[model samples]
Target: MSSTAQTADTTVTIVDGRVVTPDGVIDGRVEIGGDRITAVGDSDAETDTVIDANGQLVLPGLVDIHGDDIESHLYPRSGARMDTEMALAAADRANVAAGITTKFHAISFELDESADRSPELAATLTDAITDATDLLVDHRLHARCEVTQKRCVEAVIDVIDNDNTDLVSVMSHVPGKGQFRDIEAFRQYYENANDRTAAEAEEMIDERGSMSMATLRERVDRVVDRAHEAGVVTASHDDENPREVEQLADSGVDIAEYPITLETAQRATEIGMTTAMGAPNLVRGESQWGNLSTAAGIDAGVIDTLVADYHPPSLLAGVFVDTEEPLHERVKRATANPADAVGLSDRGRIKAGKRADLIVVDPDPTPTVTAAVVAGQPVYHADTTIEVSR
Candidate 1:
């Protein structure tokens, strides 16, 4: 469908299914006009198309605050790769199928000479996001700045300044501490992922270990200052302690990504920073790297939003399995909470004048997406019997 065609609408009625509106689910019809929801009521309204929701649960499309696995598609392995455009297209389709309407691809800028941190790779991914915006679901760039790789900070800042970057995270991945506080555990990560010998991994760590906390603080302050000035939301990655949270709060960081402990997570909340925990962590029952589990953080009232850090589909799955308190309460972590954290006040909730970004999922606890709409456009419609307006 042409972009203009998708945006042109007066009233498209969605009837029957359990409508998960901002207030709560109600059996009713939703009317859409252009990109906004015009009305939602029991009375039938004249419209261009009618979607029989039937046994589905109509809910807001996911607002994914952080997703970095797209890089694996752009550069499949350490060396092997695919075209940037192809990777982005495939990622967009996958995100839509998983019921994500808004995706922030976390592209890292590391100073290391590894192929993953190349400026060329970052630029290509950024360009692909821009080109595919019309053809796919909403896609935005989230720059993950590795403070240890201070040299690449300026290059990433250029991308943010160019206005395509949406979120910037200041991270310090120094081997001996912080996220990987135990040096031996850090060696294990390199050994497992890269198949490098322990000795070789240690050598790499030594060569890359010159960055100190003092230098990291200085560099991160500068990057955060610049990103905030550019109107981009800033985050601190893998914080493990209250001190780290305090430091980030001092720098005006808006979000805290993956706090490593309950103490840090709680500190983030006390300081008014939105804490983002990985959806995968909640689904997997634990953090893969032994960090504080999202469930634990949520129980502590520290988690504000859930992001699909590695697995894109975890966002939907998490909504079903987040068995902490109540299902309705947990749903907010994946939906409205993340939207508010990212300052996207328009698309997260289903209400009049809000963008029509929504998904149709089976009412089952662990549901599969039946259809997805972005800006009133059907991005992924699976009902073969019901014809989608192209």
Candidate 2:
């Protein structure tokens, strides 16, 4: 659905909802003048539009730091690729409908996985992300560099120099390491994902060039330095152990995405690096690749953010997973924590003077995003049941 357009002088108010502010919860209203929240309290001002929340939750829109939903959109079927702009447009609508206002599309720069992930296409997609304008939600690029490949590292550095990426991550998906701790699991995963045989997957793995720790560190340092120079946040992906986390932390990485174990996550947290877990893992109660469980990470207090790794809907579902934590705390895992982690201070909280990126949720039968408003525009309304006075 198309968002309701707004003028600079337009004033929209979300009324009678339980607003989840940074300080605490308030059973009041939120006033949005233009693209910023002008006030957030019981006292309301005259407005051009009114969205009656009907005592539901008025929450800060989710800030998804690392989401790979675009990959599936780009490659919907085997040997089939969709138009880049069209795929991005679809992903944008899907994310906003899932209550995600800010999304960092994880674009992989790999040597030879799928044709869509090649260095050339990666560069093209990076530029596309930077140039796209007709999107529903706030879109940003998270360039995921396969550090094992020198070509991938160089491509990521080029994008960094061009100022195309908002967040950069260094990862090595070599078999028997990081995400693929077991060689058999790696082969199985590749075979299933690509619809290839075990021999083909093994051949693909064997064709990869091995890089030493020193070389890998050098490459990572290059990307990290370039990203820092460009004022972009850097992250380490699929950390396998505490030592790896410490090493990445030493390299000035600000976030660790999807640490493979609890020890790794704890080390990241202790070192003051933000730790993120997949929302699908949390909602499913286990990792798809048999890595650290999101519930386990939350239990250990190591998980700071929930990302829509491959499932946009899981972000909302993961927030309400049966836990001892309060509703606000769970919401923060998907909102404020991620925004703060990525240095996005303008949004993520339902407070005065912040960006008017908000989601209306109903939590009685199940947690559902009834409506989403981004930059003072009504992006998506689930049904006509929501009352909006124009």
Candidate 3:
């Protein structure tokens, strides 16, 4: 990714683009004075730099509330680990290149089944993210706690108390429920991914799935209460049914992420919780694990945000997929909707007096991000250089 810095006195203007604002799309210019957008529409001042969008769509930089791309960076190959700072620096560039200005790196605090998701690594990464100051994209933490695991809950609570997490999502990944409703499927996943025999996989699943409903509720309430006290947003993952989602809502969960069925998503919306689906589900037109498709959720009007999940590129690519929804609304799924969902009101919409986090998309030429500006600085530019004016 290309990076450039601008002085505080510099004025950057993006001209000749179809700017996607909160109200609708408009043919105009966006002027950035310092780190915030100073004007949207015509500008009469001579600028220090100009990004000629050339009729492309100028959109708000994506606010991805949940993306686990950091895990992939740390463990590119099985049993291989990279330095924490190196991985974070790489993830920052990858996200900014994909038009994600603000990224919440989803780190798992789970029972130590996988080395990458161990609580030890989670704490190390939380500290690394907290210390990093030279990242191009705005990076934050989304602590995902596996509710069935007491150790995981404790790790998440510790992070909340220390003020390290921006968002917390509680989930139960026990076999025969939630994401792995089919016990055999869960067994096969372990056998294939973990090099475990079928019998060993089943034994492990049974051991992990033995938590009682009362214990699960107690854990969820504990995490939510701690998160609320810290003023952090909370979410429930892989909600499977209306009753399950209702329980989460009643317990003060603010968002329902990746509900497994259309009915579950509808219930989440009905109960006034922000609903999110994976952008990969929308881009690929289906879920890998046979969950509810993002398109179906959008059609039902149950999904309020589209997150990067595992694939950062999918966030931008998913917006251009063929859908009946207007372009502006589709854009909101990646931008305004997620920003609002996470209680981030400073960015995610292209307007005056907001953070100048913006991207220029050339839609006809395969949805390329030609330029990305974060905090009023040109952080990334594609190989096809955009025209500049003095």
Candidate 4:
């Protein structure tokens, strides 16, 4: 067969699967042609490849709205770094195995000379991500700009102007306030994760004392204006108060990431900004950093999307642990809700005319991802019994 014919005729029909759609679950066969879902029903469509799901749950592949943990693979710890390309490939495989088809890697840029915010470093990492996309599922950059880092703002702006930046979040990490207002908590984090002595950690916090509130507001507004003008969505990170939420909303920020208080999260939702809660928070039953409880936010109807955050597996696990509603309802929070919030209207649900980005999961008393497909092509499969011929 010709290459195009081979690809087109390589129809993948998933049979006897409990398909999870935006609406609900149903026993059906999903027929995929090339890169789009041609049909999603029990129509007995003939296909060259068939997945015998055996009543497993087939749902949309996860769209992780924010994931900074990829950086962990590149720079595992302070002063230690790995090959960016190698780190990206490993991260891609890990995410795919966890059923994440689209991932937005959040790369933080801090302008402090003492920090590792090298312009060359950011460009190199961005280039690595762009080059690795061919071998990976959909990958995009979400630049987390520290608004207080005035020295490096120009460099970050240059990267954003490169047309590769898809998302930009305005963040200000001023110690003794906001996300790190509690000095003791900050010390503990640095001591545990960075292997710093308690004295060293305390010194770091004291050195980076809080940014001026007026300056923070101006920086946020400036970045938001530039990002929105470039067609990139803007997000507010670690908002701790209703006023912070209001400021972000006033600036037309599209998303509020990891709001630290229930009031702020509710205010974000009320003002029509999408609220993104970390999946790790849901899986742990609370935020590790003592931010707003994800379960509480979900119950309050303030959470719109679930991000992988620091753990790729948490995205899937969150769907199961979030028990405030039916399982299917919780699943939508991670899948369709995230896709909708990010303006990706195509592949959030299993339906004809949409991109066939989906996963077959074995679910009984527990859930396990068995196969993952992106754009109608099998990218990950746990069942070796099923053979394929090209």
Candidate that would win on TM-score: 3
Clashing pairs in 1: none
Among all candidates shown, the one with the greatest lDDT:
3
**Residue pairs that clash (backbone atoms under 3 angstroms), model 4:** 177-181
The lDDT values for all models are 0.79, 0.87, 0.89, 0.79
Tens digits of per-residue lDDT, candidate 2, 236-255, equal: 99999999989888899999
Reference-based TM-score of each model: 0.93, 0.95, 0.96, 0.92
Which 10-residue span in candidate 1 carries the lowest summed lDDT? 1-10
For candidate 4, what is the lDDT?
Answer: 0.79
lDDT per residue for candidate 1 within 216-238, as digits (tens), equals 88888998889888898999899
Lowest lDDT sum, 10 consecutive residues, model 4, at 1-10
Clashes of 3: 0
lDDT of 3 by residue, 1-390 (tens): 122345787789999999998888999999999888999998777788899998889999999999999988998976689999999999998998889999998999986554457887899999998877788888899999988888889999999999998899998888988889998878888778766677788786988778798999999999999999999999999999999999999999999999999999999999899999999999999999998999988988888999999999999999898789788889999999999888889889998999899999988757778898898988788845588666
RMSD per model, one decimal: 2.4, 2.1, 2.1, 3.3
Alpha-carbon deviation at 172 in model 3, angstroms: 0.8
| RMSD (Cα, Å) of model 2 | 2.1
Model 3 spans > 4 angstroms off:
1-7
